[model samples]
Target: MKKIGLAWQIFIGLVLGIAVGAIFFGSPQVATYLQPIGDIFLNLIKMIVVPIVISSIIVAVAGVGDIKQLGKIGGKTILYFEIITTLAIIVGLVAANLFQPGAGIEMDKLNKTDINSYVDTAENQESHSMVDTFVNIVPTNPIAAIAEGDMLAIIFFALVFGLGISAIGEKGKPVLAFFQGTADAMFYVTNQIMKFAPFGVFALIGVTVSKFGIESLIPLGKLVFSVYGTMLFFIIVVLGSVAKLVGFNIFTLIKTLKEELILAYSTASSETVLPKIMEKMENLGVPKHIASFVIPTGYSFNLDGSTLYQALAAVFIAQMYGIEMSIADQVSLMLVLMVTSKGIAGVPGVSFVVLLATLGTVGIPVEGLAFIAGIDRILDMARTAVNVVGNSLAAIVIAKWEGKFQRNSKPKSQTTEILNVN
Candidate 1:
C-alpha cells in the first residue's frame, strides 16, 4: 500500500472486496456482519455532502460580484450543458443500435423488477417541457432546498446571494469578504478531509464488493464492460479533444483529479467528491469564481456520465424489447435527454430516474428499468467519475469562453495551506 499508488491500492481493495463478497454472498450472517462497514462509509460521505454543498455554494456565490452576470453565465451554462448532454445521449443511442447489446438476449429469462413502487415516485420526478423546466429553476425556500439537497434550488439561491453581495456597493464588501472567508475556511476543512481519501475509498469498495460479490458481476460483465468501454472512449476521444482545444492535457487532468474520481467512484455519487474537486480546481489555477459557479452548476446541468448512461441504457432496453426506433425518433430521444438531464441534479439515484422519465420519448419499455437496476449501482460508479471530469472541464471551457475565468487562486491557496499548517 505504501509502495504503490492509491489507485493500485484501491484496485486491490476492489479485488479483495469482490473476493469477500463472493465468499459470503448467499450467507446472511456474513452479509449482515459486513453491512455496517459499507453503511459507515456511505454515511460519512453523506454527512459531509450537505455542509460541503452549502459552504461551497455560499462561498462560490459570494465571489461572483454581479448577480446580473448570473443570467449570462446561467444561460450559457445551460445551453452548453444541453447541447453536450444531447450529444452524449445520441452517442449512447447510436452505439447501442450499432452494437445491439440486447439483441437475441432473452429478456423473458432476465430478471424484471416491480418498478411499480418507484413508478409513482418516478412519475412525480421530472418531465421535459419548457415551462415546467423553466418554472422550477428558482427555489421557493433556499434553506429547504439545501436541507433537501436540491442542486437547482441551491444554485438559484447561491446565484442570488452572490449577486446580492456584488450589488450592494461598498456596503456589501464586508459581507462578501465574510462569505469568502467562510468559503476559505471550508476549503481548508475539505483539504484535511481529503487526506484520508484512500482509506475511505478502500472501505467503501470493500463493503460494496463484499455485498455484491464478483459472481454477481459475472453474468452482467457484458453490460458493465460495454458501458465502461463507452465511457473510456468518449473521455479519451471527445473529452480529450475538448481538453486539447483549450491547451490542457486530459491525462494530466485525470491524474490530478484521480483522488476525487475515486471518492466519487467508491461512494457512487458525483456530489461525494465535490469538495475535493473544488479544492483541486481552485489550486490548479481555475479561478474561484469559475470553480464556484461552474462546478456546482455543472453538477446540475453537465452530467456527461449520467447523460452517457441514459443514452446507452435506453438503447439497450429498446434492443431488449426489439424496438426499432427511427432516425428521426432517435434524434428526438437525444433532444429529450438533453433537456431532461438538466433538471435532475439534486436527485438521488438520478440516472435511473432520468432514464425512466425520458425512455418514453424513445419508445422503450419502462419495465426495462428493472433489467438494468441490479447493475445500475456499479454503472453509476464509473459514470459519476466521468461526470466529475466533464463538469471540471466545463469550468475551464466556460471560463475561457466567457473570459471571466481567473487562473490565479494564490490568495485562496495560501490561506488554505496556512490553515492546514496550523
Candidate 2:
C-alpha cells in the first residue's frame, strides 16, 4: 500500500473543506468555530519567520570566505528569477486576456478595500526608484526591521552583519558558529512545528472555505481559475523546463519538495521552509555554501508567484476599469513588477503589499484588491506553493550554474518519505 503521509492528510483536509463549505453554506456557528483553528496555525508559522530568517541569513552569509562570490550568486539568482518571473507574468496576462476574467466583472459600486490594513508605509518604503530600491536594503535600524519583519531590510542587515563577522576573522568564527547552531536549532523547531501540518491543513482549509463558502468565489471564479491556472503552468512548465535544462528530472525535484510545498501551502509562509530546503539541497549534493547562500536569499528576492499575480491583477483591474494601457505602459509595469516582487519577504500578506506596490507604480486603483480579498486565503495556497517551488528551483539552478551542484552519483533512489520540513 502507498504510505499515507502528511501530504495525503492535507489532501484530505482540502477535500473535506470543499465538502463542509458546500454543506453548511452560511451557518455562522460552524464557520466561526473553524476560523480560529486556521488563525492559530497561521500564527504558529508566522512566529517562526523572523528568527529563522535571521539565523539562516547570518549562517549563510558568514561562512563564505569570498564575499565576491555572493555578488556572482546574487546576479545569477536575480537574472534567473527575473527571466522566469517575466514569463510567469506573460503567462498570467495571456490567461487573463484569453479568459477575459474581468470583462463581466461588475465594478459599478466598488466595495472599498481597507487599503490601510494591508499598506506597509513602514517609513522604510519611501524608495520609489531604482537607486532607492537598492539602497533601501541597508536597514536604517536592523532591530526594528527584524521586529517588524521588513525582509529587504533584514536581508541587508544580515549580509552586512555577516560581512562584519567574516571581517573579524578568527574572532568571527565563534559567532558564525553560533548562527549555524541557531540555524540547526531552528530547523529542529521547524520539524517539531511541522508535525502539526496535517492538522493545520485540516484547520486552515476547513476554516477558510467553511467560513467563506463557494458563493464568495462565484463572481471571481474566472479570475481565480485564470490566475491559478497561470501559476500551475509556471510551476509545471517554467520550473520543469528550467529543471530539465539543469539536467535533472523535474518529477524527482517535485517529489523531493512535496512535503515542503505542502507545508508551505498549509502555513502559507515560505520562511518556515527555509531550514528544510537548505538541508534538502545539501543532502542532494548542492554545496553547503550554495545551499546556505542561495535558498534564504531566494526567499527574500525571487518571488515568482507574486510576480505572476501582479501582472494578472494589474491587467484584471485595468480591464475592469475599461482602461486600455499602451504597450509602452505595460512594458514599464513589467520593469516595476520585477523590482517590487524581489523585495517581498517570504511572509504572509506580503504578496498583497507587492500587488499594491505594483498597482501604485502603474497608477492602477488599489481598490481592485477588495475584489479578491474574500477568496485570497484560497488563492494564497497556490501562490505560496508556487513561490516555494520557484525559490527551490532557482536555488538549485543557480547553484548548478555556479558549479555548486554535485550530481547525486549514488544508486538511483526516488526519495519517497517526507521529512518534517516546516
Could you tell me which 10 consecutive residues in candidate 2 have the lowest summed lDDT? 413-422
Q: Can you list the residue pairs that collide in candidate 1?
A: none
**Candidate 2's TM-score:** 0.85
Residue 173 lDDT, candidate 1, scale 0-100 = 62
lDDT of 1: 0.71
Model 2 superposed RMSD (Cα): 5.3
For model 2, name the residue pairs that clash: none
Ten-residue stretch with the least lDDT total in model 1: 413-422
Per-candidate TM-scores read: 0.88, 0.85
Give lDDT tens digits, candidate 2, residues 342-362.
Answer: 654743477677777677668
- Model 1, position 122, has a per-residue lDDT of 63
List the candidate 1 regions with Cα displacement exceeding 4 Å. 1-12, 57-61, 68-70, 126-128, 404-422
Instruction: Please state the error at residue 166 of candidate 2 in Å.
Output: 4.1
